[model samples]
Target: MGDKANCNCHTGNAVYGLGLIGAAIYFISQATSFIMGVLGFVKALFWPAFLVYEAFSYFAV
Candidate 1:
């Protein structure tokens, strides 16, 4: 009766997801003040925007 589906893929996905979440938490905590910390967390949630902006700024210079 050992016909159960293997969960290796699910386990791998959970590990990857947790790692990304930990990185996001670290990114959000880099701010020194209450307001900035909150803003940083929001920024982390939408980090692609910041990435694009930084890319543009770097290229524009």
Candidate 2:
């Protein structure tokens, strides 16, 4: 007998990927320079953190 653990993480990954793409597009579109575009891509990678921080801030009041 084999014990297999079932995991369902693909949906979360898909959502995160979509959010990253959307954030990258919005950030890059507003950037005026190549460096800012690069920064935007970096920022997109941390979008979840920013979202959490903003949510906490909004609710902290």
Candidate 3:
């Protein structure tokens, strides 16, 4: 099985890790920009929502 078939576990982990990295990048970008006024406001309003999303993604995987 190791030699003949490709394992999907590693790929899934890599994708989940990449998703977290991308989320961090997006959050940082949103935080650093002053022009994204509405987005910033919305983010502030839903910070807990983001946290919940992250928690579920991390734990439910």
Best by TM-score: 2
TM-score, every prediction: 0.47, 0.84, 0.41
- Model 2 C-alpha lDDT per residue in residues 1-61, reported as the tens digit of each score: 3445655459889999999999999999999999999999999999999999999999994
Comparing candidate 1 with candidate 3, which one achieves the higher lDDT?
1
Give Cα-based local distance difference scores for all models. 0.70, 0.93, 0.65
Which residue pairs collide in model 3, if any?
none
Off by over 4 Å in 3: 1-35
What's model 3's TM-score? 0.41
Candidate 1 has an lDDT of: 0.70
Q: What is the C-alpha RMSD of each candidate to the true structure, in Å?
A: 5.8, 2.3, 8.7
Candidate 2 regions exceeding 4 Å error are 1-9
Per-residue lDDT over 1-61 for candidate 3, one digit per residue giving the tens place of the 0 to 100 score: 6856864557866765676566655665767566575566556555657888999999995
- Looking at candidate 3, the ten consecutive residues that score lowest on lDDT are 37-46
Tell me the deviation in Å of residue 32 in model 1. Answer: 2.8
What overall lDDT, based on C-alpha atoms, would model 2 receive against the true structure? 0.93
